[model samples]
Target: MAKFYELQRAMRAMRQSALQRGALAILDLGSTKISCLILRFDGLDPSLASDQVGSLAGQSSFRVVGSAITQSRGIEFGEISSMQEAERAIRTVLQSAQKMANLRVDHLIACFSGGGPRSYGLNGNVKIENQIVQDEDIARVLSSCDCPDIGDGREILHAQPVNFALDHRSGLVDPRGQIGNKLDVDLHMLTVRAKTIRDLAHCVKRCDLELAGVASAAYVSGRSTLVEDEQELGAVCIDFGGGSTSYSIFLKRHMIFAGSIMLGGNHVTRDISLGLRVPISVAEKIKTKNGGLIVTGLDDRDLIEVGGETGDWEHDRRTVTRSELIGIMRPRLEEILEDIRTQLEIAGFYELKSQKFVLTGGTCQTPGLDTLASRILGQQVRIGRPLRIHRLPQAYSGSTCSALVGLALFAADPQDEWWDFELPSAGYSSRTVRKAVRWLRENW
Candidate 1:
């Protein structure tokens, strides 16, 4: 636990250093595409900024000075499958973005969508030593939370204090400077496959770029897609990427749960290819141009040419009705949505007072997806796009760029994680005792 906290602190310090340098790059390493964005900061403190001037109040302190994207190779399900190919792809996108910006960046903050993320909720409390809640008190309470054994091959990616409480008062966002006898905290920790993270780090190092920070794509997607009201009340943001479909639940403006299904847009494209007897490339084009969940009566009469590259003219001139395409596509989509529904139910999403579900990412661009998601997930569903950032190109302001945009916002104004506070070196052994006491107090 101590080693994990130390690593997190080091990463945080690296991110702070990159920010102080006034420039860094954001990378979204996904299954189908590799995206890079160069952001230049103006040395302005986000807390002093106005909402009207930035994407999020006190968080939009950077502008996109350059952007580049390339087709991902040797990556599957959001994990690097081939080191050489993934490295080449990363180098390509970074070089293009740097060239566009006419500046070189040595630091990068990256987000990815795979690695089998698991979420755990933990609670802890600490008695005030100085009769007032200070930074040390906050740190003590956070460190008191029991760190669960997530598994052998997994590592904690995010350890955030979602809620704080003071003595008889609860629901405090911050307890510092408050006169309280005791301080309590509810923490949300997300863990992912250790190998996946290590592979990403190795790839970045091979590209000769310093990895300043890292984040889960699901959490960052929720950060960008959910509006303040939805986040404050309660909402689920589903990110449909090419390799995976990741969803996160937010309450009180903090992520409480996050999970991902390995199935995503790539699966749908493969289904189309098999069902239509077409190549993968052709299937992708058809899926993008003609895919839909709803099949109208006129669709039966509408014909879409599924041209093949074969030299035989007649074999290349095949055509299928729109209804046929929808028939092939709907089942897989339904399966994906049903899987999401099951995960959400397991997470107790229905119990939330506000159960809005927001859909974003590249695959969510398919026509009629919002309507289909509403019927499958819930009625309170809406399609989401990334919040606007300063100087962001219109082409990159869609759902597909949600994670990238959120990463920038995160780099500017990150929430307080466990490592942000100062914990005493000797506090590790007391974690189990604190957990037992809290359990007894609540149960007895």
Candidate 2:
């Protein structure tokens, strides 16, 4: 809930500052790519402040002034490996983006994947004063929650209030300004190792930029890719990147569960390199150019030239059937999806009233991936692209850009949560919520 309040606050601040001449930036720190976007807000109307993200109307309010991508460094499996190296990389990428946009941005919001994070679902109830649930009342109720100590070496990444109820009614997006004596809030809090966050913050600071906010890669991916219907219904988003695959489950347009696997496209490349006895660079090029899991009779006859670095004409010239390549790739891909399936099960994903799956991120581009994933996940599956924006180049429109694009949309229309509300004594506890779930299972 605190994270939700912080995001809401940042959104309000961005809206107010949109009238300024310079651009506001969004930086996505992923395992595969570090993307930077510089946005120029043209209108004074705050409603036009954000890039439309979730609106199904396909509105055209904001335009992307400039965007750039660079190979990420000093990060492995979503965590920072070297702070100085990462900082240098951040400066280089942002400078390039600024140059392209012809604008210098003072503020930047960053997203990250690995933090050794943990999540908890918390719910609280409060009796309203004067039988009216105003914004302050909501804030008060959230404040009343005796938030747990998320451990010492960790920082709170996102404390989002996912759902709320007024009296006996549930699924209220906004309970503010409503007349009600009883108010309830369902919150999702994500906490990461403090060292991981500090490293990211230090890197951003070195780039001479203010860290407006930071978000979990999984949460941002969910925001960028999942459709409104998928969000309203229960669904999971699996973001497969270069070195890690992040997962988040959303219901009622709010995130409920989040996690990541320490495996990605890089692993696939490694597999190809080791199995085919080729260089990593060559393996990557081959994967990007001809990688696919589903084998066909046509593929058996087709041969791909395998380039060699030794430059010996006789030894360098080699060819392999497409089917042999798929043999090496399919096992790694299946392992990734299976790991995600394990996470979903642990998160009680099957308990959802609706079960749908959306796959995105760079690695999701492998041909026939959706078919392979659906067979394992056992749910309706589709590739997701970033939504709620206009003027995006068709070449940049794909599942891979969802995180970067969603970061932009999240910068626009942020939602308020329990942390923004006031806190009072004598509220419900997380244990109580868990107990209630257990009771429901026993009774229903």
Candidate 3:
């Protein structure tokens, strides 16, 4: 925990340095495509902003200087399967983006979707040392949180203090500067396999780029796509990616849980390929051009060419009705929705006051996803895309690039995390070190 605390603090410093330098790279490592966004932070806006996060005017805070997206290789379920291949893919996109931006970027923030993410709820309570809460009190309360055993080889990726309560009043976003007898805090800790993080960091380092910050794909996309009412009351954001589907639960504008499913859009493509006896590429094309979960009376008349490479003229020229395509895809899509429903059930999502569900990600645009999802998951389901950002290309303003867009916003102005505060470690609390620093300053 101490080592990770220091590592997080160091990354915070690196993020500040990146912002100061004005160019920060944002990377979204997806299974189907690897996307990169370069943001230029020129100057602050005059709009009134929250003290915790400097600016609320999202669009004006940062401009997209450069962007690139390329086919992903050696990546599956959002984790790097082949180090060299993933690194090569990363390098390819970075070179292209830097060329477009006409500027070199050293500091980067990245997001990924794999590594078996798990969430835990932590609680801590402490009596106020002074009449009002301060930085040390915040740090002390966070440090006092007793975390459960997250299993071996897993490390905490996001440990955010989701809610703070003063005495009996709950839902306090910031307890500092407030008078309180006792401070109670609720933390949302997201953990992933340590090897996943280490491999990602190594891959970034190999690319000659610094990984200033890392985020969970599920969590960041939720922040970007879920609206204020949905997030504030309660909502489930399911991001359908290429190789996996990531889901996060948000309440009171904070994520309480996040997880990933092994199956995603690529699975649907594979099913189409097998069902239609077409190549994977052809199947993907067909799926994108015509796949849907709904079957209408006219679907039987709608025909799609299932092209093949086999020399047999009849076999190569086979055609299938839209009804047949939907039949082949509906089962798999239902399976995914059923799995998501079961996961939400396990997370106790049904107990929340609001059951809003927002679906985003590239695959989330599958023709009849919302209609089918509403039937399988719940009645309150809507397809979502990332919010518009400053200087973002119109081409990138779709559900397909939800994670990339979210990563850009995250890189621009991030919300506060536990690591943002200086903790009560020996380096922070040791009197001898403080005295030595003071004495050196006085002597000099």
Candidate 4:
């Protein structure tokens, strides 16, 4: 724990320096592609972000000056499978984005969808010695929470103090400066496999970039797609990426549970390749140009040319109807949705007072997916796109770029400093931790 927090402490300083320079790059690494966005700050104060921006998921006081995306290589299920290839992809994407921005950025904040994320809800309470909730009380109560055994080789990616309570009153977002006997807090902790993070960090290092901060795709995607009202109430966001699908549950403007599955849109593409006896690339193109879950009579007549290789012209130039394509896609999509449903059930989704599900990410663009999700998941379903960012290009404003745009929001958000709620342990940097809490109190 001390080791990871120290890394975060360094990242906090790096982020501050980059923000002071008025430019920073945010990268979203996924199984399908890697996207980079360079945001130019408009002389905005971090301490006044939420108040000035009005809490829109992607509406922060930052303008995207440059953006580039490249096909991901050597990544599976959002995790780096080969260090050299992943590093090459990162460098290529960064160079392109930096070229467009005409400015060099040394620091980067990255988000990824792998790591097998798991969420834990923890609570702590402590008596206030000064009869008022202060930074020390916040730290002390946070330290009092019983840390769960998250297993060996797992790293805590996010430990956000979501809810605060004072004495008999509960559900306080901030309890500082309030007179109280006891301060209680509800914290949401997200953990992932340490190897995934370590591999990503190494790849960034090899690319000659500082990994200032990292976020799970599940959590950050929810941050950008769920509106303030949906977050205030209860909402679930399913980010359907290429190799993995992540789901996050937010209530009271904080994430309570998040999980990911290895299954995603890529599996459907594989099914198409096998079912149509075509190459993976051809299947991918077919899925993108013509893919959906619901089939109509018109689809039966909609013939799609599934091009291929090999000397057999008839087989190489084979064609299939849209309905046949949908047939191959729907079953796999249903399996993925069923997995999400099972995860939600395990996480007690039905217990949420108002469950709203928002399906986003690159894979969600398949036509009629929302309708199928509504049938399998629940009636309350909507296809969500990331919130509009300031000066984002039209090409990158689709459901596919939700995580990248959301990464921009995460870079602008003070909530990334959740590690500031550290335990009062030996060698604790009290001043630094207190500074993070102050920022959250003033801005978050």
Clashing pairs in 4: none
TM-score, each model?
Answer: 0.92, 0.86, 0.92, 0.90
Predicted candidate 3 versus true structure: per-residue lDDT over 1-444, tens digit per residue:
445556666777788888888888999999999999889888755443344555564556788989998999999999999999999999988989999999999988889999999989999888887769998788778777887899999988887789999999998988889998999999888999999989989999998998888999998898889988998999999999989998999998888999988999999999999998899999999999998889999999998999888999999989999999999998998999899899999999999989999999988888889999999998999999898887799989998888888878777656655567777554555678889999999999
Scored by Cα lDDT, where does model 4 land? 0.86
Candidates in order: C-alpha RMSD to true structure: 6.6, 8.9, 4.8, 7.3
Q: Which segments of model 4 are wrong by more than 4 Å? A: 1-11, 45-60, 416-444
- Per-residue lDDT of candidate 2, residues 1-444 (tens digit): 444455555554554464253457888887777888887755433454354444433133346777788888888888789887788778878998899888878878788888866888888888888887786787766654557777888777776778789998898888887888899887887888889878887888888887777778888889889888888887999899888898899988888899988999999999999988899999999999989999999999889899796878865888889999999999999999999899899999978878888899999999999999999996599998888465565655778788887877766544432343433434667789899999999999
lDDT score of residue 10 within candidate 3: 72
TM-score of 2: 0.86
Error of 2 at 138 (Å): 0.6
Tens-digit lDDT string for candidate 1 (317-381): 98999999999888888899999999999999998889999999999998888889889999998
**True-vs-predicted CA distance for residue 41, candidate 4, Å:** 1.9
- Identify the superior model by TM-score, candidate 1 or candidate 4: 1
Mark the regions of model 1 whose C-alpha exceeds 4 Å error after superposition. 45-58, 425-444
